[model samples]
Target: MASWRISGSRALLTAGVALTAVFTATLPAQAAHAPGGVDDWGTVVDTKDCVQADAWLVRVKGLGKIIDTKLFQSHYPTTPQAPKQHAGGRELINLAPMGIGLGKVSALYSRAMGHAHPATTSGKGDVPARGEVYADAGGAAVDIGLPYIQNPAGGTQLSPFGVHVEGITVSAYSQPGKPVAFTGGAARGYISVAGTRIIDIPPIWAVNLGVRIPEDYTQAPLALATTNEQVTTDVKGNPTKGPNGAYKYDPKATSGYVNGIHASVLGTDVADVTVVHAAVLRDPKITDKFAVAPRAASDRAGVPARPLSKSCAPFAPPRTAAAGMKDTSSCW
Candidate 1:
């Protein structure tokens, strides 16, 4: 079982902690539902599941390292950050977002698994990689970036609940590669109806979604690629290639940024929908979490997403960007 542990304690806050809402038994059973052909056994949902995959922002502190270390120590194809190195057949260079200055990559995986602590064991019975190996972050207290839950392959446990929604929405909040107690990262969203329980979490340690081996690490954050159309971006965050090239991206060898799987949720009635809120980080002392909780289905009638999150002010997207840029800009 490949795993890592935060032996060094630093009172980190747990993000998206479930404050305790009424269980599935509470929600109204009114609306007509559709799984959109999604299959369910407990663990795996079939192909056509409908979810409102929301785009999340990976915010980080101490990002000025890029401006400082012109070398920008980068090592993706897995390593979040590493010193610039080059050789003949054994050369490598990490790209931007270099140093885990943000935090540990495990934070992202832990979030998707719906917990704050990194697991010592893999999801299935997968073998463990050496535990001592660690990722390099520029000393951030935390970081995060993307989704999932695994149920048994055959079972009708989900049938007991009559309040089933179309499908589940998967989300992951993550950090860089190493956990710095002060920095933070998060990605949170609701799954209308997925997973056996409310947590609706999935394992990122061992279960393979699409990442390549060696690079597809056990503690690294991951997402199930929703589409096959790969879009490769470059050091400047520009489109440089297509169909994700080999993983374990070699900076001095090839384009730096390893193609990443960007994701979002899809479905109807997401306004006040029931979602699993599990942020891997968020120090209890630091109540001011930079990220927002996943929105509930808007059609939930009078139900409020937060107990008293102030009256709903109109959500306004910033209009300051170029004319057409507003559409793609984040709502935050």
Candidate 2:
């Protein structure tokens, strides 16, 4: 039961999101390899290691410009669990705005939230919210962020920045403010809306998504429906049930840091991580499509069919629902 998000403070600081308020959208998918031969999501952890390779993105939000590695620093070092440094500083390489001393943390708030607020102090250690990650600050993630925005004039506008997400293989790995921690699960790889079409626009595009590593079809953060529209965490790590006494779905996100793309918002839309694309990165790369139903038919062969109902359970052989409404006959 994901609802439209309004409050940001009450949500879990690690990868908060309630993005379902937006309309129907589908995103794209890309590669299966991490840049520079980086192994799974668990590797290269440490402030310095994060600063070296994972901190900066090869792609920039704008053209012919290079984004420094400092734009993705975890702003909540005060939080207990944040690593001294994180992979890619936890953000895509983009030229987001920030105050002078803030560096990457500045861009982190700006991008995760939205444009630097009108009253924002320029080149200073400040966070300008726009009903987004920090709504009270005036950020609303989509209302004023990127890839898509509904203007005060009732029209559509694109984000100016070409935001990008390499991919996700982590889930609430660590609760920020606690200390650097991995959820100790094998939920690997998810492709979300990586690159936006404009410069200065946050990567919050029409669609966002992530899929488990293809090698293990029955991975954690399972799919909500047979469709690619949503991602969920099944019985892989810890399953949080919905109001109906069933497991809730989450957008398949990688990091839990406040500025992390997946955790910036609040609610179940980020119950996991929002799917920015139809990420089927195991093999035979899809046309890089957006969210679509019956993804099992289009995905690589040999993979098990995903749960097709809101119950979040695996389907029985033949993948059909039972006749009655109380049918618990399928993947339970």
Candidate 3:
């Protein structure tokens, strides 16, 4: 329903010329994967019943007009940067990570209804507010600091077979009122019984034991309260009131540091787990337009959409690696 096309012959010509310039400027790497040598999985498993939740806070400040003006003139000489500096201009002030877990029901809704449901439910239908906020604030603070640099060390993991580990790990500097995007790797482990049925069902039967190593990230928002003494000065500038007021600040907002831990269970075929379809729940009144699509159990039969990789050679360890010794290792 939505298109990303820019119109007009002039605009098209300009875009085509710019694209050609960019492609010609850069050389393609030899590796089949991206620069980091990580394979990308295009799709996730259809585990229709799971829950996930997270919370974060960030702080961002503008670098003042001088920086803004320079950035504006350099990037968009024809138009004001404030209105059209669409890409690459921002700073991350403070980014602290905390933890937020979605309830079991909520996870189930997401798995069944797809990301769009929870995306809309969370009041972020398409545009990720967290990332956009940083982009905007960081763009404004370019003069004070360098443009926001994506943590190359953090990002999604794409497996060889098109199994995409969305938001595996990410890093963000702290800023006020800005939220960092959550990207962490996830995995599920299970044991299956070898047996054959007389009829249509396959010979192999799979049973989900649980998530072997749960998804984890240390980048959620944490709230902290501190007291600062504000001495009211008389005309002579003498100290006035004692430090008594407590100011509440999300640590992630100021530090741009986040540490989070996440866990969840895959659904069992025999268990008949009850789940809320986010799309349906978000718009229950729309009879003509079904928000949530029904997901039959068969959709998850056989091998999971995202089978674990045989090796973890391509991926770097999680961002919060300690002593270079991780308990478990797998791409997805």
Candidate 4:
């Protein structure tokens, strides 16, 4: 099971924003697209002849500005088999007193772990590029020290001595000419104080972020997902209008991502952390040039693809109960 364990030395890092504990798990050999036996840990991966996953420890910011530098980071392209990744360090200076770091620990520690993978299975008679693609990251974790702390109001908060975040995952799956499906969450983890468990953190799904809604339908803290059906926009961030009085949408584009933790103190944002993140895009103009059947029929018919689901898969951690993790059974 995924439990937050406080130890002598642990570290946390991230791409941007707040700082918080995160957890990670090893990647399994079988792809997430496989029917079963796929361990969900960090964010899964996706593809468009190109896909990538990233994991990192701490990144500190204050007053909307970056203070600490980006720490150990792991980035890699998608592959046939899932790959495990880990990164961490010790003796880091927590500049919280100076209004830049997450906590006031003199010797802050950090670490991150996760798995990422992208697998594609093609169908015969590839006229219009018929195939299924799956990308996911699982078993993510990150930790940091908070021996002593002061809130934004200048009071001793008696913060935890250590913090550990675990069980973060994200994934995306799709077929040619179909809308991309995204699924992931933070599950089965907690924070600690003085080497003892304190509170249980609830699972968070990317869909609830509300960053992109009624437009993209799903949102994660630092993630983005999209498809060709998205509306085209002008440079001013306004939707473009076509000659037929209808909104113009880009004929090609797609993406996916996973959720991580963002740590804050007394209402002030400190750091942005992610156990794993994956992204994928598709361009129909380029992809359809070699299609066995012309894609114009669907375009002429104006047949929009199926609507995306409001929920996603948990991509559960290693050996942990997947009881709460939801799956898009309709897609399967």
Candidate 5:
């Protein structure tokens, strides 16, 4: 089975932790509800389903490296039907908020999912590449402020449960010799009835939405940023030209980024939380024993038309600046 693990003595947090709420009761039933028709299982192949970023923000002290790095880092693809199917290459459950008990109890939440192969059939899975922030009533009540700072206003002051947003997502697919097709969007709206079970704690104090950086800080703090980042390569994991006499991205050699999936109460100045995050990955390798080759780009003639799930709509294929090359496909 193709798999990867972030092993260290450091106390890294996972979504499974700190998720003890009455809302958790309905999680099992609602887990199948993804923003798009994408689901966790299907005949997935020739896809880069490893890249994802859930949060990127500095914490006071050395707390930054303790956040959930498992969901933020890449997980190389693996065949679901394989004898030894693993967690990688599959959609992960949404991360609940993490509690940082400083002067007062503050909650930190970052929700994101990495890329995966195209959904051949409609079900419930992640939107390939997705990232979102909990800024509504379905979130923590207290504002995440800098506890180390003498004055709370001197550092970042933001609440996880403020404004409601649909979040962002990126989807991609490709063949051996063709450029990888991609698509995505930034969905901003109110929390739906299905999402309420994820979190629904009203604010106790007059908490506001978005990032609140102090005037003393020079950097422009952002409450939420969409992630549509990607990298590509040839079979050898190196740059290569395509049939169109231009550079192209192959699924086997491509990589995607989901940075700025962050929310913080304090910007790192002295401590190392901002310096060494938990989700950082070095030159990783991919090894899927049961991996299958994708259908040829020109073989769309006989490709079966898949219906769009009622919960999600179809997306157009990725666009490229490469002249004489056209990328088009229907995605869930």
Candidate 6:
């Protein structure tokens, strides 16, 4: 079983009209590529990359212009993951509030527990032996951190940020009246940030942060059983039994972490402003044993499928707003 939770604080930030207008007008042209021919996601293709080559950088700058700098100041901590030097000595704040969401999918596996019984005879009087049965079912599920923020009008904003997870899939390969080797489905997920937050002002730029879940999957069940007796009660508690020990099933659970922030801006001038910076704190630990395999659909018919694993890297945070101005003297 899995559960979700969300929480956090609020505030305002600063921005101006002139800065907004220039950012809006010139950004699209500059966002075509990165300094070294890198794409918006930070995949550097070449070295002589100009601002026009970095679409992600341009978007972040535009969004930064719309953020309220003041609101962000209050949330600034002395030691942040992103050093102040990277932000031009200005406190980089997170504007979004933190929240979480959880979901799960599972199914019964065995219909009968491992146990043999003798048949009853009608001649004189003999009670028949009843064999134990267990349920056999399994599925996948997910959990994520939902990033939220407040607009100038006092309305709240929400989006998926931080880390995300996919539950393991399960499969059993055995016939009735015989022992079978049970294998669980694959599980996956990853940590990430929103691209929009890296900007000095978020409204001016539209870049977004993203992380790809590994194509690797877990094949071992979170737990397993050998016989009806073992399934009934061996270690991890009575094997999720059903009504009067009539049936039993495997028990499973999954968890992960999320880290990052959100940004929003409102105002006409570059002077007066408010900014909000929200930080995510998470500590994840794996307490059980499981098998890991490359994410790929099994060719066997009737088996659950999974996507193949591929290379995926997170994009680098954008340069600070002050640095953007320094990069383009003409804009200042």
| Leading candidate by TM-score | 4
Which residue ranges in model 5 land beyond 4 Å of their true spot? Answer: 1-68, 72-74, 77-117, 123-164, 189-226, 233-332
Candidate 5 local distance difference test against the native: 0.23
Judge candidate 4 against the unseen true structure and give its global Cα lDDT, from 0 to 1: 0.31
Estimate, for each residue in 1-332, the C-alpha lDDT of model 2 and write its tens digit.
Answer: 12112221122211211111111111111112234442212112222111111111111121112222122222111112211122212322222333211101111111111111111212222222111111110011212122222234543333221112222121111111111112111112222221222112122211122212111436443222111112222211123346897544434421222112332222122222221111111100111122223423322122222212221111111001111112011110
Q: Supply candidate 6's per-residue lDDT for 158.
A: 26
Model 4, runs deviating above 4 Å:
1-135, 145-163, 173-175, 191-199, 203-206, 209-253, 263-270, 288-332
Give the per-residue lDDT of model 4 (tens digit) for 98-166: 333343211111212111112111221111112333333333444443423444564334344334445
Please estimate how well model 1 matches the true structure, expressed as its whole-model Cα lDDT: 0.18
Against the hidden reference, what TM-scores do the models get?
Answer: 0.19, 0.22, 0.15, 0.37, 0.32, 0.18
| lDDT (0 to 1) per candidate | 0.18, 0.20, 0.15, 0.31, 0.23, 0.18
Candidate 2 off by > 4 Å = 1-36, 39-62, 68-72, 75-154, 159-171, 174-332
Candidates sorted by TM-score, descending order? 4, 5, 2, 1, 6, 3
* Clash count of each predicted structure: 62, 66, 52, 43, 11, 80
The CA root-mean-square deviation of candidate 3, after full C-alpha superposition on the true structure, stands at 26.2
Pairing residues by index, what is the TM-score of model 2? Answer: 0.22
Please give, for residues 52-106, the per-residue lDDT of candidate 3 as tens digits: 1111111111211111011111010011211211112122223111211101000
The ten-residue window of minimal lDDT in model 1 covers 131-140
lDDT of 1 by residue, 176-286 (tens): 222211111112211122333222212221111222111234633321221011121221222333357433222121111111111222222111111111111212122
- How do the residues 260-328 of candidate 6 rate in per-residue lDDT, one tens digit apiece? 112222222111111111111101121111111331313122212221211110111112111221111
Instruction: Flag regions of model 6 displaced more than 4 Å.
Output: 1-132, 135-141, 146-167, 171-181, 191-332
